[model samples]
Target: MNIEVSTANMKFLECFSSETRVRIIELLREQSRNIKGLSEALGIQPPIVTRHIQMLEEAGIIRSELVPATRGMQKLCILQLGEATLNFKRPEETHVPGCHRTVVPVGQYADYQVSPPCGLVSGAKRIGMCDDPRYFGDPERMNARMLWFARGYVEYRIPNYLVRGERPCMLEITTEICSDAPCSTSETPSDITFTVNGRELGTWTCPGEFASPHGKFTPHWWTKTQYGRLKTVRVDGSGTFIDGVRTSGMTIEGLDIRPGAELRLRIASLDTARHSGGVSLFGSGFGNYDQDIEVNLWYDHHNNAETGS
Candidate 1:
């Protein structure tokens, strides 16, 4: 997760300030623990542990759920974050040039051709029957927060707002995704390909389907899949990169993207490809990250074109 290193994020930064809170994070990382278990481990009173847990939850560093215990119920706390990147650069940094950002929901795809073991769900309930490709066309799909498929492609159309003299320098797409394995297993790997404007950008091999006791934002009733890793695919003058690691020789210029051009992004799990496990996409209220698929386009003046970071 990326967070600005500003006073506005002191809430999250403060989590590491106290030794007690830091120790709590360390314990939670190994495994989920209930409040009673944590209190005993820390040798602190239950009220004190509860306060630390509250702070962690408010900072989005941890999540907790109420589960039935031997007597009544216990609050089980789980670590929510794997890693965090502190962005020191300010948002208004002028050296970065002009940029535009757009967020598209996982279900707001312009086109799709998926196979069975596919379905869509909102935070509350399922949109249609599971493993039925026909449900992809459901009218209520626009409200979907999570979607999965065994194979095939799902495409989204990104809006292009570049005016006359803006030269495209970079395009970045960020989303939470994973392999769509049956029975919610994480052992499968899938080679997912990405395309922009019909040009293949690159293929990323997803490690596997990710699961947890519960997602930070996902509802408790739903448990088929848990969460996914957040990935950022970037295309620039030099090459295409996934999370800053160059994955292909494809460049922004090769995509033919320009002012007022239609930007169609397609994600596919072709059957012919090696490790064609599947694909699962998570949006706001469905994954650890409370966000939709985000796209950012950075540009420079035609007269002063430079490489993008």
Candidate 2:
């Protein structure tokens, strides 16, 4: 019942649109109430009550059930997610445009193939058609529809050029991981933890419960199935994710790149029963987003380190 709000739960925290929503949630928290009870207690019109209730339901703040009382029938609404905690931070002032240290490292394996259970899917043919069980993985595709997994592999070659005359220290590779996204358009929560050079980097909770372009980034007609939201784990020096356990105030460390060393990205998932919701993935490149997992190497190019926002 505890709702931890960080930038990750933007949608949930942003659901507070009106004071009615706040008051309605307060009343529902005490006990499940029918529309008539809410309307009478709040002294509001029936239409207003209904409108607020709908918004709360969409925000997943309350749940409703049918209760037969002295009356013929009554719909009872109760609070769902609770213990809400939110963190607000002031925006830092800085300016840097069209500058990302990352570069697309993997070349298109036009004739790539994945085993029956999985393989590389083309990013071209994947935008907006991910709800289907069959659109899992298909090579040579782009713009969405790409998924494949194994004991963890490596992509994005860290150029040996960085090892010219410096001592090798650390390696940094970035990618996304999943337990195995279910074959349906259902809400599936997962925890994809990362490890670097055999070191357990940390764990991240992927609350696969958001929206995306069903057919395109911003389609005109909205023909595709707008399912749960998605996420992209970006890689860099300070921006690296550490113990992001609470989805709030989470920070990362130990990402300093050794002057010269091969970096490896080791991704794995644990079904600790803590998240029995199961795993499901849909990215623009994997079957939908800008591209597959983006990875980059951060090192002291000339005795000076660079920073990313």
Candidate 3:
């Protein structure tokens, strides 16, 4: 029988030694306070509070910041550690499990073989529905599409665990996305979405325009078409979020790939009512996000999480 534990659990056990560290956590749980604020409230000296704060920061139990205050500058701190527990193993180690198979981060894009009912669009405004390379830059066309049924799933292999026999129970895949250029901003929300395994994850209604959340203004040309308003919707509730907000859906769970597994993500404007105005996906070559569509998977020793069981 095999049992496993996570790195997060050990860190918590290590913190139980210091009472000062524990009190700081209790205080921060109420509100974020600066060093001076903490000293005054706890009736401790600045240097002592600073020392304990340093230890907690090193332990990953809390984080600190230097923000301007009306009176002067101070180091503001907050606790980030959450509820976690650990299971103990005997000190006299018996059989040691060797390195586990792991999945490394990789990039994913569209590949074509047999698009049952979908198509493709190229840069410079050309749409390819059952298209040939000749449609690469057709002025009348401006979208790329490809599709299939039963075999509809696209493939993206993720080698989540890097060792020999370890498997992962949870899989996290994150990517910033948008697809098929819509004729108008109002039409951008109708894109259809799916995973590689023929499992219908869900759909995301993108913002009418791709706007930069970083405060940097989007370029003029891209504004006409919804190209800069980057919006992400999760496929599974367990997926990671982008811009610390959007997340991917259940692309894979209880994942058990050794080297890697093909990650297939397919997009279609399936909302017939809105997709009737079909759109074009402006990947890599032209967009403010300044990157081609990317997908990241997070897993451990064995199978995937949501799909792993």
Candidate 4:
């Protein structure tokens, strides 16, 4: 599970502090086991293993189910979170001086064009009927925490929230996303493009949709086999970048994000792409990152003052 360290439950932290408990977690990572199996594998007493299991369960790190055994019922222990990250730094700790930031949930897109094999879901449940294009216009889409489409784009209107008289010098967008394949499995490559204020920023080719141990925060009710990888795309004076690597020749000037300009960002799986594998966007409580799509606008207040319009 992705947990902010500052606000993490004390009990959760305590679960990781003991060596025995850590070993238990390691063993479970290989596969689920009963208390007897865990004790035998770890060479610990049955009562000691039971105690550790209780602590892990209380921390939401593991869960147990009773299974019919040859003699009687046996409790099987399984790991709940496939991964976990403790973010020790707070938002302010990593804040840029001249940057204004905003976060938009994946489902809050202002406009969209999607093909079939598409659907929307909140953290708890599906928003509307799946695979039906009409549901894309449903008002409940605003509550969407996750959404996927086989092709087309989702547009978002980002408010220009920078200081007065300051124009953006750079823009960065980060989100956890993956290719949307039929049945959530595909090895096909898809070129995902990004546009800012109608200007083509860049395109990144997604290798494939991932599967295995589902996303840590992904709800149990949802039946998806895999989740997205976190990605950060940036546009600046030089060029566009994905995860700090330059991917496009397009520069910040091409976008023309002026002080009063209406800011809009669009993510698309173009029809002509080499791989029309589709796309899935994840938000809080839906993806591995446990965050929404984040946009950061960096500007120069001093430069604005010197211009003196």
Writing each residue's lDDT as its tens digit, candidate 3 over 119-145 gives 443344324444243333344332322
Worst 10 residues of 1 by lDDT: 300-309
Count of backbone clashes, every candidate in sequence: 0, 35, 80, 0
lDDT of 1 by residue, 1-309 (tens): 567888999999999899999999888866678998999999999999999999999999887855435566477786766456677887665244578899999999999999978999988999989899999999899999999998999999999999877888888898988898746557788999899999888887876776654777888998777887677788888998775556789998898887798799999999887998799999999877899999989887764344332
What tens digits encode model 4's per-residue C-alpha lDDT throughout 145-195?
Answer: 888888899999988866566656678888888888637545656788888
lDDT by candidate, in order shown: 0.84, 0.44, 0.43, 0.78
- Off-target runs (Cα >4 Å) in candidate 3 are 1-163, 169-176, 179-182, 185-188, 209-251, 254-260, 271-280, 302-309
TM-score per candidate: 0.69, 0.40, 0.40, 0.67
Which parts of model 2 have CA positions greater than 4 angstroms off?
Answer: 1-100, 104-120, 123-145, 148-179, 209-256, 271-273, 276-288, 300-309
For all predictions, the C-alpha RMSD in Å is: 7.8, 12.0, 11.7, 10.5
When 1 and 4 are scored with TM-score, the better candidate is: 1
Tens digit of per-residue lDDT, candidate 2, span 1-309: 124446666556666867877887777656557898899989999788998888788767776644334545467776655333343443233211111244332332122222223333333333324333333333333433334332222222333434533322222333323434434232455566555545555566544422332423323343222322233343332343321112222122354344355444444444353553333334443322344445433233332242221
- Ranking under lDDT, best-scoring first? 1, 4, 2, 3
